[model samples]
Target: MFRMIPPGLAEAARLTRQGRLKEATALLQGSLAGTRPKPTPARPATRGRIFEVDPATGDATPPGRAGFFSRAQGRPRPAPPLAMPEGARFLRGGFGAAQGERAWRLYIPASLPAGPVPLLVMLHGCTQTPEDFAAGTRMNALAEAEPRLVLYPEQSGTANAQRCWNWFQPGDQRRDQGEPALIAGMVRQVMRDHAVDPRRVHVAGLSAGGAAAAIMGESYPELFAAVGVHSGLACGAAQNLPSALAAMRQGGGTSTVLATARPTIVFHADQDRTVHPVNGDQVMARAGAAGLRAEVERGQVPGGHAFTRTRHSDTAGRVMLEQWLVHGGGHAWSGGDAAGSYTDPLGPDASRAMLDFFRRHG
Candidate 1:
């Protein structure tokens, strides 16, 4: 006679087949918590040297108990080189003014020729400086290849200790308020200082910064031609933990398209842990629901990641969405240079794609 198998047992069997027996077992044990404790991997104690550098003098402070690169143990490392392209310039400071805190950073491609040039704004994630983002994205390389000006707006740790974009907060998500205003202000400042082509401006970011890019596109449609979000979600679609979780699980929301001026969109994501892959689909869906013509194109890249492209159509032209869903990738920048943080240069080059998309719109 045949016997019935428990759901947990079946799940464990599936996980074992997929080489995720440990995770499967954990899930099974958690489901039956009262019966027995779940087994866990033994984590080794971490040990490393800590080095600190002063941003002003570019000098090392000294090391402490926490190994080098440990913020808690070391003084603070000197700000790394921005690795900007030749002729890049530092524009005005104080781009972001939120909650009595001031944010600042540099702008690249200092000199634009007689004709207007496309503008690309790069936002950094939590615990990151503008210099770090510039170095990581290596967008400067693309800026050099193409005639686009890149803007780097920094987030002060004093405002939020984590240096996150504050997209999760309601105040920062609204237009003409908090980080959104500051980011828009920066865009305006760049336009005023340089001959930036209004029709070709684009925005891109990583993690929390990615979420902020979506917010910028939602709030200031006329200001940005297209937006690139790497591993982030649409604003208002995720406000708190539960909403964020749901958005991550299901993807997409019903936010109106902000860019009446031009086609709005491009979203890149990895199917790995950390940020959910569904967020990419939700972004595309939101763009489509707003009457923006959307299309999805699929391909494969290095490191066994599947890349998808979703393009939105408008009067000006089609806005492209390129999602690089790395199979086992985590929260990191794809096709980034090794010198940058959390970058896997081996993956499809996102910077190149951003430039190509911007050029198409321009």
Candidate 2:
């Protein structure tokens, strides 16, 4: 059967041919992940440094009292990749608003050109840190070559048991309250600190993060020019814990596809057992495809899974939405680095694709 090249990968190959090969490869790391250092063995528990953090309470468990946790949880995996890219800076900061305060990590590129730059807000999945998400998605590495500023708003363990963005909660779904307001305030804070193109502001996430990104777009359409959702549900997919579980198993009943919905790009695997693939359809529905031209393309990453991408464009031939369904893939970030959690290195490069799509709208 004939196949098409995933657009972002194709563009990367083209840019590589035009002398961007080294930079793109360094950033995209389609293969750098293969050379990632082997997982190190866990260290012996020492008296002073051996504290177990309670995932539920974010409190330190006395060293001797870690027996239950040691039995319950497996050996801790190594830390996520948190090294700053050469010449780039990864700084820590915090933002507070009406709802609450959240600590965030900001990634600023090196040798940035004069004037305003694009700002991307990234949300991490449950049990993921900003550093883990960046390493998983390879967005920070990509920003090293692309010059966009990336912000990762971290979810506090105290906010939810799993450090999730509470996207399924009714309070968090609206603009002026809850997580949405806090996150939007962070965007404005970044804009004030650095020159940012208002039209170029965008947000994207994985799983819970992806769901939160949809909520951000829905709540603050005027702030985000576009949104990217991967392995996530549509905004308002759930309003409570029970409904959230059901929505994760199957699509939900909430439906809102306003014409003003921000431009959206989505990725979901047909084999994802966590968030149902039908939720990807729900997210696209929220993008409002009415009156747009539709085109579908099939592609496969070399030595990776096959994918079907549908592009929706306007009368002017500008793409407004893209949805990719990866066959045989799970609920991980697509085409991600092995150094981070919940990443499938064999899938398509979702980071590059989402950024490419975001750049088009802004």
Q: Which candidate number would show the highest TM-score if scored against the true structure?
A: 2
Q: How many clashes does each candidate structure show, in the order listed?
A: 14, 0
Instruction: Provide TM-scores for the models.
Output: 0.70, 0.79
lDDT of 1 by residue, 169-188 (tens): 67888898888888899889
State how far residue 18 of model 2 sits from its true place (Å). Answer: 56
The C-alpha stretches of model 1 lying farther than 4 A from their native spots are 1-79, 84-86, 96-101, 245-269, 289-298, 302-306, 310-322
Predictions in order: lDDT: 0.61, 0.76
What's the residue-level lDDT of 328 in candidate 1?
47
Model 1, position 165, has a per-residue lDDT of 79
Model 2 Cα lDDT, one tens digit per residue, 1-362: 54332233333333323333233333333422433222223333223311112222323233333112111232334446576756889989999976899999999988567799999999988657788788788888788878889999998756853567888789999988999999999999999999998989999998899999999998888899999999999998877654565577678666777764359999999988668899999999877876788899999999999999999998789898999999999878899987777777889999999988987999
